[model samples]
Target: MTRAKVLLIGLIVLALGGVGYLGFEALGVRGFSAGIAAQSLLVLIVVVWTGSYLFRVVTGQMTYMNQRRRYREVYDAKEREDLEARFDALPEEEQQALLQRLGLDGDDVRADS
Candidate 1:
């Protein structure tokens, strides 16, 4: 993570801690109990956030995984195009021979199909 992100997160946590403390105080909790309650609230929030992230990962909904999937699709498409171009550049007799060697009929080798 970047330094700025770390600093921002630290500030957020501090703010949440203050809010938690004030909330518990408003409920008549004081001193050590209020401090503990605030800390527990923070821990609960962190646990829920982490759990949601894990759920996204396990369900294959993560942005990083999506990006990698898109990259693979584009790379495979380019590779397929390159292969077709190379095959098209071959002499007619060589193309026929290749089809024969591969046991693929000329009419059945359309890439889109």
Candidate 2:
């Protein structure tokens, strides 16, 4: 697993451990007993919930970051030029439709430059 995934798992573990400690209080666990069994079950629920969310959240973040990175890597002058070249080859009517779809045909659209 990636570092981010590992970190998320570690966070989930710590959260679960905290929940377990809380349960131990409810179950009347003392210093010698350490953990209360009944409360420990509740702790399992917390661990499952948090771990599932952590897995999904961290994975989603990583996927999004990777996608953006890929887009940046592939988005450059050549791609723009290629798109423009293709657009330029189209007839006026088709080009107008394309530009409209791209929001590039707006009459009032102009840079502040």
For residues 1-113, what per-residue lDDT tens digits would candidate 2 score against the true structure?
A: 69999899779767766666766766778653545554466567777978986987877765677788778878875687797688668898997786688778635333411
Q: Write the per-residue lDDT of candidate 1 for residues 47-107, one digit (tens) a residue.
A: 9989999999999999889999999999999999999999999998999899999998778
- Model 2 residue 44 distance off true place after TM-score fit, in angstroms: 3.1
Q: Would you give me the overall lDDT of model 1?
A: 0.93
**Total clashing pairs for each candidate:** 0, 0
Query: Worst ten-residue run, lDDT, model 2?
Result: 104-113
lDDT of each: 0.93, 0.69
TM-score of each: 0.80, 0.30
